[model samples]
Target chain A: MSARFVPVPTPETGTYWEKAAEGELWLPRCDSCGRAVFYPRSFCPHCHGDDLTWFRASGRGVVESFIINHNPAPGYEQDAPYVIALIMLEEGVRLTTNLLGVEQTPDAVRIGLPVEVVFEQRDGIALPQFRVITGDGASG
Target chain B: MNRAAGSSPVIIAGAAESPQLGTVPGQSAMMLAVSSARLALRQTGLAWADVDGLASTLPVVDLASYVGIRPGWLDGTVVGGCSSMLHVRHAVAAIRSGAASVVVVAHGESGRSRVGMPPRAVDPASMAGQFEQPYGMSGTFSRFTLPVLAYLHTYGLSPDDLAEVPVAQSEWAAGNPRAYRDKPLDIHAVLSSRMIAWPFRVLECCPLTDGGGALVLMSARRAADLDLEHRPVTVLGSGESCEGPGASFMEDLTSFAGFREASARAFRESGLTQADIDHLMIYDAYAHVPLYGLEDLGFVGRGEAVPFLRSGATRPGGSLPMNTNGGGLLYTHTGMYGMFAIQEAVRQLRGDAFAAVPGVRTSFVQGIGGMFGAAGSLVLSNT
Candidate 1:
């Protein structure tokens, strides 16, 4: 049986998947409009420019908000309740990521809590998750 | 205190539910669309031949072929749940511009049966599939549940306010015979219900049901030419807009700007204000939706909806009566719940809804598609 579900990456988004597999977060930077694109787009969202550059991100952000799921997802029955969060990165963009190394509850998770990207490899595919850099259990 | 009450070019001649709601067996999604269209056409005293235009939330070519109406004009706008509401707006534009005379807007969703849209075998593939889905998250329950915490924390609200929404809507549902849920729901029932996600109980989510609804629209002049039994509900003004692609892109998680922009355009075009509306229908797929709608639509100030809701302003005999169809929470939510709101709006204007607000001259319906992805607002009136 497969350890996890890995999405078949499109030509446009395959770069993001490939970079994450190498333990690096590569975001698209628009040469024309200078806007940072997420989910690996083909064109610059700011100017619709096709000319874009890839750069490894600082991978630092804070929790804008989060929710703890008590229900089971399709591929993750053993991990019923987990924290899904919108992390506002230091580069002024937000992305959805899982908050790890903390209690998966509201009391444990607070808005503006600092987090850092930590990639976990499952079946040779790297999935990006967040861990607390500074919080109630910062040292933990 | 005078408002625009602007003249409208088009009016809804008739509308109908699929007549087969809840667990509709063996009926495919397209089948329900055809059935609902037929029901609505019957109400208008028109035949399939009179349908010169057809707008569908489903695949337009398939539904058109299935309904056997080769329309002069067809709109297949598939944004999300609010697609049907935009269809009404688009249909009006189509007719007023001499695109088509008689227009039929239909919605058919087999949310429970999963006829055409099969249940997830593999995980969904989208932006969310890449980011949120991998983290034991994905599905309507997980997507919508993310907003509650931000809303509550931003507004300094408690769990009790969230619990009160479904409970109050259930009271309205109890009065509606066609409402899907027969079991009584209360504050304790909602809060104590199984927590699907943090701060969202199972009762807070919309039930998966198989159903459809449709509307038959024509020029106001055409409505006056015929002796219609029901009051002709005019489409005075309509508004629609989309914000970011997803909630993650939204700057303010607490409020939806799309709802505000859409509702404002409708009101501004109609020359109306929040005070002028006698009734309202905000899509409540979950309890927090109404909270977002109320504040965003300018019915109440930001953070004022909780107190307003607690005051029962949205209940029966209130100043601003809303969601008399029991909403998606208790009433039939065939996935896209917008048309049900339109059905209730038309019924209220015709003076024949189960929980009708007294002297309802104007009804405003707000249709939400996706998680703040799109919105459609319509100002419907009998005047």
Candidate 2:
């Protein structure tokens, strides 16, 4: 079986994965349709256009949804009770990431709470995670 | 035009579940499939030679050769949990197109026995792994349970509020003799159960087991020709749809577009409204899935399912009785629970279900694949 902790990037998504290593959120944009494409795809899902470009993201979004995992997730056992969230970015894209700097309880983490990206770099890999912005930005 | 709204052309003439569900210690997955296939064939009183169409998540060649079937048409649409439901739709289309008759859709798994399944990563090197695994995430329970948080937060429901799902489903299971656990379930028991994932206790998840199920769908002519004691169940409407393979690609976490599209097309095809449905079965992979399934199918408005279920709407004696076979939660899951869903629907329509719903003239069955990657729904009526 393949290792679950490492990334398996293809030519299409190499740029996006490499940018994550540089502590930045970069995604592709279709030049033909002017629609943002996610998951580092080869073509625009909206227009099926092949002309795509990459750009850095604003790294700001709100929590659309999330779940707290109290069980072990292989390498993430120590991080039990972790918050996995679907963060909807301002650029109209949504991706899955962890919620940091917040209590693991449901009352602490909420939908529509404003969050910002935080990069975690180790073992030559950098991943973008989300943290609920404290103070005025925090809804709950 | 979809066939359901136009004409009802297919009839489910035969259906069977493995005689020994929960487990068959020595049997391989193939043995389970063949056993169920043989049982269904006997029910239809059709010989193996009469089977012209074959479908399953397993390779058709493996199951066919084992069962000695030389199918004229085959469908290998394995979309995780919804595979069998999708196969039924594919078979309906093929039967209508004059491609074949007497289509047998089967699903067999030894998830409990681990007889034929391959070993994979807690998280694999698929598209999901490439994007999310680098962060050290693993296992499906956590990844799949993430939607409940969204559901709770969106609807202002608490984790305890969601506890009603498994509790009520267990009540129905209590009446099912074949159910894995028929003991009464309560919100207190569910909330205090071991937390596999926060907000999702062990009871909220389906128990893995070993079993197989098969359904025989024949064209109207072939079905009419069948000389069987069991009443035929007509396929009044059927619909199947896929939303790719990635969970993060979902436009809405709390609701599924695939479920909505498939069920809408199914009801439209059936020419039946929500009030017309007498029974319902949705793949209960976890506690949150039913909530999503109910809302997406428009059985209830958004933010209505949790409260509706809490009000005993899906309880055994309640209006719109659901998952009467104890569902995947208390009943047998056997990896893909879709086949079991179909089997229960058939039994309920035949008025022979162990946890039978009274006078089930119309049943709507939905099967979900992956983590909302695909979904298929069917409207069945007693013939």
Candidate 3:
């Protein structure tokens, strides 16, 4: 069976979800501070500058860190065990997503694993995920 | 350098914990917090009227205000596990600045007993909720598993090495009247327990405890006036640092840079080295935290904490008597074990611990806030 379904989004963050629906990872870059910000916001957290603009990302990054979850969360009981990873975008922005297309084991995942973005549709929402690049020995 | 040569020093006048934790039913989070606060005041021979500034975790903000403390400069820092330690540091600052002569830092959580609080909906556009939570990183348990598994692989340490922590801590708890899990757990029993996550067993994880703890900090001048039963444990040094709210921002999971920096600042400000600490009260939300904390705090070299534990360096009368009150492993972990470490450190300095280490003139306490995201350290000396 598929996992429990829910599509929850708020006005402040609706722009982010809207962009993701088009297969685009739109992150806000502060016009004043020149820092790329994730998790959509109205103002730059760094300089509190209101001048912000959304930009598309390269969608390719290295797996800076990851966790092989043996236990599942309440809503994610169907997928008892999965791999959750923190991907460091080439733009210097970091985002967390599930590492798909790889075995969920300690031996399978390692630091500096090269991965590219893949979108998983859930409840009509395109959720960003990652998979190990083929031929990459980093994926054990 | 003598800002106030003979000014009142802020000290931990008293500390206390709720009676029934881990399995208590029908007790609201506020009730547990109030009980601990009252007990702390009683221990210090003071009353609610004596407190002017209140510093505490976010969960107990309304409760603290209801207990007759004016909320002029109250701090409800919600930094996950290190909530209480951060509150302690804020309390010291409040007392020193004369904002309020007497400050209380308290925390409590009723995680096991359902409080009927609504689950907060995730906003996908928000930085954390959008970027991290959707990918299945819901809580600290899931996030912490990465570094823990990696540490095991890097060190070639077996689950048995991890089991020793709960085993030894449970043995310490057997002697602690207030510890929730007082039964002596053998290594075999610990290893045999069901797994909560890979490399972490049910025994290895802390219980969803329902408890509260409180500490009172007063200016040095005010501390001298009170007819205290025990000498006050002075806060020699304190420091805090944050690594943002995401794991990706960190440079190395194996080495907790924030904790290392905080510890260094605390030790330097206190003019004490690792060798000077007679006892330690490092936070142990999970078995691996103490191992990593020791390494990050310069107590042990990198990848060497496992061997140090095997050598009995952390047990009572060993090289360093750590977490003598059973820690969160055997004690109660109300989601914020960092505050409990501070309480234990004060108890040790005041010579009131169940397994009090002799000549404990100095004590070191370290707390991890988020998944190694933030850290707060304190050095207490009976000078």
Candidate 4:
């Protein structure tokens, strides 16, 4: 298979990729709104408060929605019929990620399935992905 | 002619689709835009020199130079496919506020041919590039269609419900000679067609075609002064709203917050309700959009759009005939399809639509941009 897209981190989001490399899921919390933000930004999208802090999360979420794309993106030709999903984190944030460790079928993948974050290393960067949680592994 | 006399009555004096639609590899994007602009301009009894305001998502400078317009007002509001809807809204405001008297809002896209089209750009460090695109989320098919499953799951609806949209619209498409997919469609054909993504078939998707449409907006007073042959289509109300960058960021996957907000504003400004609308045009880039549009625009209740569509309420001879020009699913979708939506609404109100609905005194037009990132709504009338 060809190499997938490697994300180039910006000044505001460098720590997200860096922390994922160290096997941790980190997110920014707005001090004013008491909310966690995804894909990292300078301030709270909710309140526009500049005072934000980053912390490690539980690295767990549930499949909120998904599509089994038969037509793949570039470098994903070999991985057609893959599951591209929206994972809603326990921290009350949602993200776009791939669901791993499961067969790419409707019966195998479903909404509300518990998933935990896993990283795929590409070009010295760790891109966060998810896999289905089985056997009492649901995170609180 | 002046039912909206209390407020400044902004009117679409002229509207026209390009001489060529569906496929015209011969013309560049600018050429298509200019061609439609000229057609609309002729209807208004105005010359390119008479256009004082210009608006488009295309290269505005090139459009201006080619059309020989030195405009005092120019709006280059580009928000994906619904950019033209916003342009019409802005043009209305510009005309009402005396920013410019003669405004021409235009759109042209070589979505299929890719002739003279800009390269698709994605900043490697941007949010979507870093997150969504890396997950192998295919273009609009995968990205925009992501929320449909959630919408279905939340409502306990099936793929059958999603299939009903194109099936209903195809009836209208058959009557429209200008539509790209003129043949009638059925639910069985929709379900049996090639599955592009989960819960969406190839038949449910809009075709990639090249087309251009333009609308000329001026005050009713200005249009009457010129004594143009065309009846003025008054802009009763218009509203626009924006949500987060991508589909996942939407506040609710089952519903669109931007659509609700924009439609509410349009209704409020128009002082009209659902019952007063005789015609509706919701941008159906995909079949799922009209479902969301009906519910979000308050035409139907939550989880009721599927059944409403299946009931033959939006088809020809229905109470509220919708997408009379076949919409984007069967009509020509030139990437930014909002201009086409507005054009159909104007045609319906003027009783000149290819598939005309009788006595369409008031028409409502709604558009969606990006992956549900933005929405624009307009209320128009011939009274």
Candidate 5:
């Protein structure tokens, strides 16, 4: 089956997607205020600091919370019954991503479950995802 | 800001709402707004010509102009769901500054019945359309649902725990003659309802309504001198804050900073705390919105709202009478839930609500806009 998709990249967030392709989560850290920022911006919104740095993350976190998708959007019909979770990084940042490699039942994906980052190849690009870090040797 | 000598005190002189607003067919958006405006003017013993300031949400900009006097000051604030509360706050400022003597804030929409207004053609060169829309994060429901699910997971709360808010609010609605959903709902009924997106069943979501809500704010001097039998309610304090829009940029789904900031400012200005608020009219576009808002507003400790709700603190006649007018869950939600909060607060203060509570001298109303990205809080008092 052929899946049609497109990626729209902006100047501010282009580096983020590029780092994700290489199996890394890149966030802008304000040099002056030392805060990790998202929605990638050129300057720090908090302190208006121009000094910024891109750093790699450990890619390990727990599910802060999640919702199961029973009604998939039009283009995502095939991916019905998926789990969308807010994963809280150890560094105190949260991002939305799909939890793959498990049943999308509410009972199966409890809140605060341990999760580890993984990537999937979608339309020649690597998209970040997460899966439950089961102790039973099931690793994505 | 210094108040002008001749400025009005900005009291809620009148309020009116349309019946069964969202599901009606053949009713235009303009008609809904006009009917509510007329009802409010009649209730306040004022005429259309008496209104000098007109404010409305983006959905009904043109319609507001068509139904009222030519406003010397017009404010069309479209900050998503909290638009009405922000409008109320702005109206108070305008009145105190002597920019307008009388202001009317109104909203109405057939959001549930309408489908597919053609998408605006954004510049292909624009980064926003290219980056966000393609990821299926176009609508407010989809974006807000993501954080709600996360909040549920982290708290170890079941769907039933989240379901209790709507179930109890619907029960309150059952007693309200104007509530759209008058039937009582149990926890089981809420859990068994069709899932819109996993943990959020149909009952957890606010209905798409086509109703109109209007509130008339006049100067304290003018309200006191009016020959009308009903006394107006005073605007004690108001506060507003806006955060980044997208979910990715939010600090935490469970903790909305905007609400916290706005609520603190409102409470500080009003010289009241959670203990002082006898009534609460929280914005409830989704059941979870109020759950988070309660925590942000310092009514309960973080992650403790579920139990606070379970113990029935938010029910009618409880320690805190909350959403006594049925709220957005059972009352009509025309995209913006802010108007309903203002209406409920004014009614409670005036002792004119369908589900009026006794000894309600002070009331608090909170409105959430744009997936918890913005918040507007108000405190009203009979004293």
Candidate 6:
């Protein structure tokens, strides 16, 4: 199968992709506001502080919201009937990610479903995705 | 206070849609905007030379050159679909400051036909491209409707309640000749329609259409000097605010903070309360938006908007008539729909609307840009 769209990292977000390559989910936190930031930026969104520190996150979250996309983006025609979800991380930041390893239906995937990070490698880029957590060590 | 209410009054002398609407595949975006501006100017019995200020999503210089007017003041603030609402607010400031006498705010988008539209491109290094679009986020259907499930789960509401929005708005559309979907709709019809996104059926979303609309704003003093034909719709108050990067980054899943901020500022500047509003027009790119607008604008309490809409309070002959032009959902949505919303408010105030509500003394129009990313609010009155 062909590869999907890969994100090109910027100066502020280069470290995020590098850390994901090592199977670590890292995010920047503002020292001034004591808050975590997403889609890493040079300055803090909350307090406008330049003193942002990168920290390894817990890599766990709940499905805050989602939509089952029937239409697909470029390179995603085969990936239709997929779940595009908003995962609220334990750090209080939300990331738009794909929910995998679950039946693409309202009965299977739902709001508040606990999930953990799983990376998908795409052409030298590591994308952080999420899968439902199962106690039996089996997803979905 | 904002300039519209704090300083000398500015009024919309005339507002009009393009001569062709819904499907004008022949005209480009600039053509639609210029034609609408011509209709507006003609309605006020003024020529292109009378317009000295320009505001639009189009490049102001290009719009001015094509329309044969050299604008002294220009505002091209773009925040997605609500850009026209912000333009009206900014035009009030320009006129109040004496920067320009006659200001025209216009909008045109070849959403359906894509005539002369630029190819959609995204910077690989941008925040949305790096984060949101990497997922299966395709377009407005995926991104704009992202928060809807959370909104339903938070309020213990069902998709049926969300379906009620289009059902109610369709009642107003039934009387509108210009509405894209003027037939009466029911919740079953809405739920049974083709699913664009989960919990949002095709009927619940704004139809992709080709259209354009414009408004001519000048001070009451300028209108008098021009001896305009129509009754000037007073720009009582206006306000705007932007949230974070996009819908996923919104602070709250259920309530839109930008809507609350923008509407509060508009009310405060107008020195009016919700009780004084006789009409309402909340931009409905999606059915869930009116629910957010009704609640965030303080017209109803938290979690009360769905019930209020189901009660038929916003339908024609109801207590508060709303979306009288059938709104963006049933009316034409040229991608940027704020200009059409403002046009309906002006028409209702002028007593010339297709679904005109009797004795509408005050109308509050609210608009949302992008995926709940920003908001612009305007309070207008006939008296």
Model 4: per-residue Cα lDDT over A1-140, one tens digit each: 66777788898898888899998989999999989987689888889998889999988989999988888777889878889999999999998888898899988988999999999887788889999998676554
Model 3 C-alpha lDDT per residue in residues B1-383, reported as the tens digit of each score: 23222356668887887766676677877777778888888877888877877877744457665796565568878887887877777777776766677777887767667352235444544445555666665466665655665566577776568887887676567856678788888889989997666567778878767777888888667766688767788988888888766555556667788789889988987889999999888788788888888999999998898888778888876888888888888888877787778878888888878777888899999998866778999999887
The lowest-lDDT stretch of 10 consecutive residues in candidate 3 chain B is B1-10
- In angstroms, how far off is B203's CA in candidate 6? 0.5
Which model, 2 or 5, shows the larger lDDT? 2
Candidates sorted on TM-score, descending: 4, 6, 2, 1, 5, 3
DockQ score of the complex predicted as candidate 2: 0.58
Question: Per-candidate DockQ versus the true complex?
Answer: 0.56, 0.58, 0.35, 0.77, 0.42, 0.77
Candidate 2 vs candidate 4: which has greater DockQ? 4
Chain A vs. true chain A, TM-score per candidate? 0.87, 0.89, 0.85, 0.92, 0.84, 0.92
Q: Where is model 5 more than 4 Å wrong at Cα?
A: A1-7, A18-25, A55-60, A90-92, A112-126, A131-140, B1-8, B59-61, B115-141, B149-156, B175-177
Q: Give each model a TM-score.
A: 0.93, 0.93, 0.86, 0.97, 0.88, 0.96
Q: For model 5, what is the alpha-carbon lDDT of residue A70?
A: 72
Worst 10 residues of 2 chain B by lDDT: B1-10
Model 4 lDDT per residue over B181-300, tens place: 898899888899998877678888899999898999898877766866677898888899989778888889999998999999999999999999999999998889999999999999
Give stretches of model 6 more than 4 Å off. Answer: A1-3, A138-140, B1-7
- Clash pairs (backbone) in predicted model 1: B4-B271
The residue ranges of model 1 lying beyond 4 angstroms of the native Cα positions read A1-3, A31-35, A47-51, A134-140, B1-8, B116-125
lDDT for A51 in candidate 1 is 90
Candidate 3: CAPRI quality band: acceptable
**Model 6, global lDDT:** 0.87
